[model samples]
Target: MSSLLVTGGAGFIGSNFVRHVLATTDHNVTVLDAITYAGNAASLDGLPEDRFRLVVGSVCDADLVNDLVADHDVTVHFAAESHNDNSLNDPSPFIQTNLVGTYELLQAVRRHDKRYHHISTDEVYSDLELDDPAKFTENTPYNPSSPYSSTKAGSDLLVRAWVRSFGVQATISNCSNNYGPYQHVEKFIPRQITGLIDGVRPKLYGAGENVRDWIHVDDHNSAVLRIIDDGVIGETYLIGADGEMNNKSVIELILELMDQPTDAYDHVNDRPGHDMRYAIDATRLRTELGWTPTYRDFRSGLAATIDWYRANEDWWRPMKAATEAKYAKTGQ
Candidate 1:
């Protein structure tokens, strides 16, 4: 079995990707996560012990990364400061983790000559508006607005640098907004669902007009697998399910799914410089790698995800109650 190192495997997309790797392939997946608030061990609870291992560590630790890379066949970097609001409050940690952390991992992988993959978001592409939504392709310019995007953009640059200077075997996938189960409550979809379940009206930012291209976590996991298994090294791929929706639209959709009364949301101040719109063109990935999503449609996916949270109140209730406590502590 090919050994794979997945950073942040305890987080939303990373965790889903890890389980996908386990179910689909015999690959021995090693997860290195900091177990931060966003990273939950429950995400990997179903993983078979023999096929999986967890390392409580940071990608910023070069020595630890080097040791892990030396033992693994493939390394996928997914750890990062992902929340847009958190990045805006102060981007320092984002830079430390998104840029410096990625740099350390690159150094480690270069030393071991191992295959590497970087997981990135579509926010790396600047605002894409107008009638024909400009789908970000492999050649799109980096125009990150938020500190979170800036940090991710910086990390993507480092990936390119390592490929050019060190000849590192690496590939990067820039994807759209991911939604599904096991996601942190801070995220849009789950935050809304769980909040509604807790007898609270969820807050919506701005006019909620910001548009996003949505991809279910499962589809994103499959796309990453295709990239790692068959993707050409030193290349970057843009993977997105063609489902694009605006901020207000998705909130309305979620509220509808939950059978909540209309007008159940409170309007919050729009985030500073909130991206107006984002969409991706997956032509290259689909044409070259023959990679596509099994659940590109969000209707059933969102329904199932809501159902999961509804059925597993034991999984989300504590987090829902602790929400105010943590924010009060963080002063957010």
Candidate 2:
């Protein structure tokens, strides 16, 4: 069994991945998280004590990172300042965590000759026009539009350089949008879900025509595991399930599913530099690694997600007010 270190393991996707690994594999996991506003330690609760541990620290701490790297057999780097709105308001934290933090992880892995996998987003490729039929692939050129995406692009470049110049055993995966349990309320899906729960109207951005290629968190984690097992070093893979939907449609559906009127939501000003659409082509990962996503039906997966949030009110209630307040300030 491998000793795995998952940075940001308490956050949305990382926590889901940690649970996935524990449930499906024999590997023992060490979670290194900074416990930031987005990182919820409670998500990792009830994990098997002997097989899991949490280390509260920053990935930018070189000494701490080196120590952790030396102890683990593989590192899946997931820590980052992921919220686009927050990044637009203040880009400094994004620079520190996404760029400098990644460099530190790369250095530690290189020094120990350990395997590394960098978790990134499709936003690094920028947005496609609404009418464009093309999707992001492994060969897509880098053209990030926001500070958040730009820093992620920088991190991906760092991993590539480390693989080439230092011969570090590393792979990269740029995944499309993820939606599932443990997601912070500030995200699009959970924001609306919690808004409905709190008797507040769901807020949409502008016309809400922007589209996102959705993938279940579990499916994304499964792809990551497949890559670690069979993917070639230095190769980059794109993970997606081809579940695309526009924001307005998604909000209306949520209202319908929650037994509310379809037109119950309100539209607000859009964020600056909002991408028009993001789609992922996972052809390479599918044909090469033989990985298939289990959550194919977007509505079904979304229904399960809605149930999760409904049943876990205590888990999300603390963050609801602040998240909505922040959005209210921007009129979004």
Candidate 3:
């Protein structure tokens, strides 16, 4: 059995991945997280104690990271300051966690000669024109728009450099937007889901024409596991499910699923420099790794997500008020 160190495992995607690994594999997992505002300790509840452990700490702590890396057979990095609006409000933490923290992990993995897998977002490719037929591919050039994306882009570059310059055993996967259970209410889909649960009208940014390619968190994690087992070193794969929808359509679907009027939503001030659309081409991952998403039906996946939030209100209720207040300040 492999010993895995998962940074930010208390966060949404990371937590899901932690559970996925435990349920599907024999790997013993240790989570190293700072338990930041975006992270929730409750998200990781009820796992087998013998195989799962959580470490409250920062990835930027080199000594701690090195110690963990030395013992783990592999490191899966999922920690970062990932919110665009939050990064716009304050870029300092983004730089510190995304750039410096990645550098520290790279150094530690290099020192230990351990296998590493870096999880990144497709936002690094910026956006395609709404009418453009192109989608972001593995070869897409980095053109990040927000401080969050920029810093993540920088972190991806650091991993590439480390792989080439030091031959650190590492691979990278840039995935499209992921939505499923345990997502923090601050994110787009969860915000709408939780808002509807609270009898609050969903809010949209601008005309809501912004497009995003969505994937289930479980599918993304499955692709990550695929890469770790069979993918070539220093290679980069793109993970997507071809689930593209505009902001307006997503909100309308949420309203419809929640038994509300389709038009019963509010328009709000748009975010600054909001990209028009984001789409991902996962041809490489599919053709090479033989991976496919289980939740190919967007509506069903979204409905399942809604049911999760409704049934598990206790998990997301704590952050709902603060998240809404933050958005209310900017009328978004």
Per-candidate total of colliding backbone pairs? 0, 0, 0
TM-score against truth, every candidate: 0.96, 0.99, 0.99
lDDT of 3 by residue, 1-332 (tens): 89999999999999999999999999999999999998888999998999999999999999999999999999999999999999999999999999999999999999989999999999999999999999999899999999999999999999999999999999999999999999999899999999888889989999999999999999999999999999999999999999999999999999999999999999988899999999999999999999999999999999999999999998999899998898777777
Candidate that would win on lDDT: 2
lDDT by residue (tens digit), candidate 2, 1-332: 89999999999999999999999999999999999999999999999999999999999999999999999999999999999999989999999999999999999999999999999999999999999999999999999999999999999999999999999999999999999999999999999998898898998999999999999999999999999999999999999999999999999989988999999999888889999999999999999999999999999999999999999999999988888788777777
Tens-digit lDDT track of model 1 for 180-295? 88888878899888888877777778788888888899999999999998999999999998988887878888888888876778787777788888898999999999988888
Instruction: Report lDDT per candidate.
Output: 0.88, 0.96, 0.95
Score candidate 2 by TM-score against the native. 0.99
Lowest lDDT 10-mer window, candidate 1? Answer: 323-332
Is candidate 1 or 3 superior in lDDT? 3
